[model samples]
Target: MYRILIVDDEPMIRKGLQKLVEQSELPIESLRTAENGVVALQRIKEERPDFVFTDIRMPKMDGLELCQHVAEMDADIQVVVISGYGDFEYAQKCVSYGVKEYLLKPVSVKGFKGVLEKLIRTKSKVSSESFIAVTLLEQWASRMEQAVWMLQDAELDLVLDEIQEELKTKHFKLNRVVDMLAEINTLLEQRLNARDVYVMQRDFDLAGAENEEAVWACFTAAIHGYLEELKAKRKGKLKDPVEEAKLYIESHLAEEVSLEEVADHIGLNPSYFSQLFKQSTQETFVQYRTRRRMEKAKKLLQQPQWRITDISGEVGYADHPHFTKTFKKYEGCLPSEYRQQMGIRA
Candidate 1:
């Protein structure tokens, strides 16, 4: 849905156009009227309407002036001039200011529909492109978050470089790029906050930046500073990675444990963490986690009040049959069979 603002000095003309637009039914979410260009421009700034229908002659500011302002302010706004005059001079002037459509005097339904359909087509195309950019930004931001937690400076730089290249090649609008950068900043800030990292003061105004380069620089600089802080903290207080992984696994026995997550939690490379874990414990990380989970499952299974399916989930297995199979393999008996041997039933 789109919002439209109708600007005209005459009240009757405003109502007539509003009625016509409502009758046309072109996906307009809102229909607003302004008595003159000044009021219309204010509404345009505040509302950021998708379409602005304005008359050429008006008090305080005319349609020509409004067209120029809209062009300077935001080219995304579709400005349509509705005037009683058939002057070529007026049409040329509007064209100079990037007015999309000029409807002379009374607007015919057919002519109005043609202009509206064209504008909607253009807006849809832009919207689809913006969607792709947003999706890519989100995916990259998630990867960047993981890299930050894992203290992988190379991975972080690689993700940011890919994002920068994508923005340049795609030629996304500066505002859209700013919005994407803001989203990345928010994600990183939340992740940092979760780990009790102090977020640096943000002095840069992303939206007010002069150009895309400046915006990208601001984002990358902030991320670099944040990464440096993480590095400093890691160096100042190094913990045993294997011990941390063990603690993490113990807490998350009821959840699916992954080596990568454990490595990230301990700020070590996943492969290095896996090797260190094996060296330290004489067992692979997966083997240790499975043993811990089975130990926990054994205790839970011993309780006669606990159901077998519930016991399965209590130790991270969501599939009851798979849990039973694994339990039989490890204990040489199914969970129910083990319970029966212990003089229990479910």
Candidate 2:
């Protein structure tokens, strides 16, 4: 539901607009009114409405002045100016301020309805929920990003699971969450060195409330703080144990990386190492390793230069059929189809 603020000097006009908005059956969370620009500006700071509907002429501050104040505070809120004078000049000014529309005086119910319909048709702009969610996802992704340069199977899946749950709960917007995660990962990689890069993917998860927006913001902040902390500890170099394991995997991508081998390499018993891997990597060790292998397979198949057998060997798959099956499961397409779709040909 979008909150709307009506800023009109006339009591009757304010009441009329309020009534029309209510009658439209739009998702109106709140309908607030301000008699003048001063009062409107004060309300503007206190409340984040989705739109502001104002009269062109008024004492103290006119519609134009009120708009300027609101615009300075937040330009995203749709502004609809009410003008009884039908003055083209005033309408033009409103347009210049990025007003949604200029409504003529004695705003006819039909005309009001038409404009309202147009507004409803327009895509929704950013909302408070999104702003908060984006912030949290960014944090979570960034923390993982700092801990592992390459995403791992265990923890990455867990994070995705949590996000899916958030979406199911209707706490977060799916697209926004994914976008924020992508952005944070990209940003983290650009800022960190190889050590930090390799460490990030294994080290982050959602630590905030499951509420979509809150979770997103908290996750984002956690990563930011962790990165700063890592930088401080390593004298600007990445020193995470997770980074050590990831670098090992990169160097041995073509080699078999069993859970036992990875755990043993990190000096932990097999089961304990698996647990550590899940805690850090966010997925089971086997799952993460399989993803890493499939990812390489996908990249290799995209080249006209690499054969299925060669790519399979490179990704530590002894059998071509197994590689093909895994790639299909993870990427939702067979390697051949994926390559063709990407415009790659042998």
Candidate 3:
């Protein structure tokens, strides 16, 4: 189902389009009417519709001006300009402003339906590909947390490279790409908080980021500087025992390692180690172990040949349903959904 906004100065044409949409079998969720482009823009800002149908010559603001505004605000909205036969030449000029289709005045049932079907098909395909791109970026964010924690500069560079490539391949708009990078930064900051490493939000001058490369340059420079500060902080610490516990837990991610076992391995009393662990790292032993297992499971899910059951067992989950539930809680999606988004077949 989709929502549509009809913009026209003529009351008759607006009523006609509304009636046709109501009489049609297409899945239209709602319909809104606006007399001019100014009103249409107000409606769009209030709640964006999937499609906007506007007449070319309206008072105050016309369809062409409306198309330009929509393009600047959201690249996803499908704009169809309706014009009289005499205005057809004028409507053709709207293509440069990202108009999806130019419809002739007195819109016919056949022509309107064809346009509707075409737009829906295009939107569906983009939606699926966008889902996959977002999932990949999220996985990259998880890997980034590890790289920063271990102070691995090479791995950080590689992760950023992978992120930039994914964004470019998807051909995302500059604003959307910036939002994605901000999301990754938020995730990184949250994970770093557990270790008492608080980083100030970088003041990104994105006004100059008119292209994908420029955006990437801004993001990488800020992140690299943040990592340098993290390194300096690590150098000030003396012999962190928690690092040993983390190493052991990461190495035996497939096994259920108990806190007492880890404490004995690190030559500390279990009680003392438990308190020290919580003081040094804000997370408890079980919480840390679960987070690592879930992150490991996400990485394994990328491989299509690996069965979901085997991946669960590999991450120390003996029960399949439990693994699915835990994964859903951690990633906000099922293991199968995650794999599908990563381009893995069932």
Q: 1-346, model 1: which lDDT tens digit per residue? A: 8888999999999998888888788888888999988898777655567788888888899888888887876436788888776654675688877786878777888888788888889888987864545566668867887887787889988998888887777676655667677787776677677766655433334644555666676777667656655664758856665777889999999999799898788776564455557757999888899899999988987888888888899899998899889888889988888888889985
Q: Give the worst 10-residue stretch by lDDT in candidate 1.
A: 199-208
> 1 or 3, which is superior by lDDT?
3
Q: Candidate 3's residue-wise lDDT over 1-346, tens digit each?
A: 8889999999998999998778677888889999999999878655567888899999999888898888876446888888999999989989988886878867899888888888888877876776435566668877887887787878988998887777778776555576678777776667667666565344544433545665676677666645655664656635566898899999998887899899778655454466557656898888889999999999889988899999999999888899999999999999999999999974
> 206, model 1: CA deviation in Å?
7.7
lDDT string, candidate 2, 59-124, tens digits: 999888877766654234678888766565766676656786878888887888787766655635
1 or 2, which is superior by lDDT? 1
Identify the candidate with maximal TM-score.
1
Q: What is the lDDT, from 0 to 100, of the residue 84 in candidate 1? A: 70
TM-score between candidate 2 and the true structure: 0.40
Ranking by TM-score: 1, 3, 2
- Residues forming the 10-long window of minimal summed lDDT in candidate 2: 202-211
* Candidate 2 RMSD to the real structure: 16.4
All candidates: TM-score: 0.48, 0.40, 0.43
